[model samples]
Target: MLRDFSAQALFMGLLTAFVGFASSFAVVLHGLTGVGASEAQAASGVMALSISMGLCAIVLSAWTRLPVSIAWSTPGAALLASSGAVEGGFAAAVGGFLICAALIVVAGLWKPLGRMVAAIPATLANAMLAGVLIGLCFAPVKAVAFNPAFGLAILGAWAVVGAFNRLLAVPAALVAFALVLTFGIDIPDGAFSAIARDLLPRPEIVAPVFNLPGLVSIALPLFVVTMASQNIPGIAVLKVNQYEPNPGPLFAATGIFSFLSAPFGGHAVNLAAITAAMCAGEDAHADPRRRYWAAINAGVFYVVFGLLAGAVTAIVNLAPPILIQAVAGLALISAFAGSAMNAFKEAETREAAALTFLTTASGVSFGGISGAFWGLLAGGLVMGVGRFVAARKAKKV
Candidate 1:
C-alpha cells in the first residue's frame, strides 16, 4: 500500500476534499440554521459531519481498497432548508436525524427495506427534489436583491471562474465571499475577537426530541432524498469508474456513522455522489488499483477541516445571512437543474412531475407537514390515477 502511494493520488485527494467541502458547506450551514439551530449548534453540526465523513471515507477506502468516498447528505440538507423551522427546534431536527440514520442502516442491512426505497419512481423522486431546491436556486437573485454589491461580487466570481472550469465555480464564489467579508462588510470592532475566541472546536451534544411532525417532515424526506439523490448515485459513480464494491455494506457503514454523529447535531452522512468521481476516476491515479489512496487522502484533510469547523462557522456568522445563502444557492444550481431535467424528461409523467415541482416550490405546509412530503404525495396520487385510468381504458377496448 505504501508503494502504491503516488503524488498524483495525493494531489487528487487533496483537491477532492477541498472541492467537496468548499462547494457545499455553506448549504450545510444554511440548512442547519434554517432548522432553528443556534450558531453553536450549527457549528457543532458541521463539525460532526465533517469529522464523521472524513473518518468514514478513510475506513471505507482502506477496508475495501476502493475509492469509496463519503459525504454529508447535501440533498438532505437542502430538504431541511426547505422544510423550514421544525416544531420543536434543533432538538426535534436531531431526533429526525436519528430516525433517518436508522432508516439508512435498515435499508442497508435489510434487502427488503432497500428494495422498497429503490421502488420509488424515479420521476416522482426527482420531481420532489426539484421542488425542494427551486427556492434556494433563486437565492443568487435574492441576494442581489438584498444587496447588489455583495451579491454581484459572488455571482461574478462564479461566472468568470465557472467559464474556465465549472467545478471550481462554487469555490471561487466562496473566495469572493471571503473578500466580501474582509473588505466589503463593516465589522463591529470587537466581532473578530469574539469570533476568534469561539474558534476553539467543541462538540455540543444536543439531546433529541422526537415529534410526529418531525418524523414525517424531516426524517422521511431527508431519508428519501439522501438515499435517492446521494447514496444510489454515488454507487453508480463508482461503478462508472469501474470500482465495484458491495453497496449494502457501504450504506450501512455510512448509516452507522450518521447515527453516531446525530447526537452532536449532524444531520446525516452518506456516500458522496459528486466527489466520489474525483477519488475514483483516472484523475486520481494512472493505476486503477491505487485510486483508493485518493479517498483516504481526502479523508485526512476532512478531519483537519472538521477540527476547524468552529472557526469557519464563526467567521461565516459575521456576514449577512444572504451572502452565505447566495453562495449556497450557487452550489446547488447543478443539483436543481439535474433534478428538474430528470423529473420532466418523460412526456407521460411530465404533468405529475410538474405538479410536484410546483407544489414543493410553493413551500406549503399543513398540519405540521412540509411541502416536500405533500408534493411527493400529490405526484404519487396523480401517477397512480393515471396508471389506473390507462388500465381501465385498455380493458374497455
Candidate 2:
C-alpha cells in the first residue's frame, strides 16, 4: 500500500476533497435549516455528514482494494429543502433519516430490495430529482433580484471559472460568497464572537420521532433519491474505470455510516458519483490498481475538513439566507441539467417524465406525503396505462 502511494494520487485526492466539500456544504446547511435545525444543529449535521462519508470511503476502499469514494446525499438534502418543515420538526426529520438508512441497509443485504429500487423507471427518478431541485436552482436568479451586486458576483465567479474547469466552478462561487459575506454584508455586534465559539462543532444526538407524515415525506423519497442518484451512479463510475468490486457491501457500508450519523443530525451519506471519478480515474494514478490510494487520501482530507464544518456554518449563518441559497443554487445547476436531460431522454417515457417533473415541481403535498413521491407514483400510473394501451392495440392488430 505504501508503494502504491504517488504524488498524482495524493494531489487528486486532495482536489477531490476540496471540490466535494466546497461545492455543496451550503446546500447541506440550507437543507438542515429548512427542516428546522438551529445553526448549531445544522453545523453538527454538516460535521457528522462530512466525517461519516470520509470514514466510509476510507474503510470501503481499504477493504475492497478499490477506489471507493463516499459522499453525503446532496439530492436528498435538496429533497429536504423541498419538503420544508415537517410536523414534529427536525426530530421527526431525523427519524425519517433513520428509516432511509435502514432501507439502504436492506437494499444492500437483500438482493430483492436492491432490485426493486433498481427497477424504478430511470426517467421518473430523474424527473423527480429535477423537480426537487427546481426551487433551489432558481435561487441564483432570485438572489440577483434581491441584491444584484452580491448575486451577480457569485454567478460571475461560477461562470468565469466554469469556462475553464467545470469541477472548480462551484468552489469559485463559494469563494465569491465568502467575499460577499466579508466585504459586502454588514456584521452584527458579537457575531464574530459567536462564530469563534462555534468554530468547533459539538455533535448533538437527536431523539427520533416516527410518524406517518415523516415516514412518507422524508424517508421514502430520500431513500429513492440517494440510491438512484448517488450510490448507483457511483458504482457505474467505478465499473467504467474497470474496477470490479461487488456493489452490495459498499452500499451497506455507506448505509451503516448514514445510520450512525443520523442520530447526530446528519441526513444521509452514500457513495460518491462525481468525486469517485476523480479518485478512480487515470488522473488519480496510471495504474488502476493503485488508485485506491487516492480515495484513501481523499478520505483523510475529508476528515480534516469535517473538523472545520462548524466554522463554515457559523460564517454562513451571518449572511442573508437568500445569498447562501444563491450559492446552493449555483452548486446544483450541473446536477439539475443532468437530471432534466435524463428525465426526457426517451420519447416513449417523455409524457410520463414530464408529469413527474411538473408534479414534483408543484411542491404540493397530500396527507403529509411530499410531491416527489406523488410525482413518481403519478408518473408510474400514467406510464403503466400507456404501456397497457399499447399492449391492447397490439393484440387488436
Model 1 per-residue lDDT at 394: 100
- How much is 306 displaced in model 2, in angstroms? 1.2
lDDT digits (tens) for residues 268-309 of candidate 1: 999999999988888999899999999999999999899899
TM-score of 2: 0.98
Any residue pairs clashing in model 2, and if so which? Answer: none
lDDT of 2 at 253: 90
Q: Tens digit of lDDT per residue, candidate 2, span 212-233?
A: 8889999999999999999999
lDDT values of the candidates? 0.93, 0.93
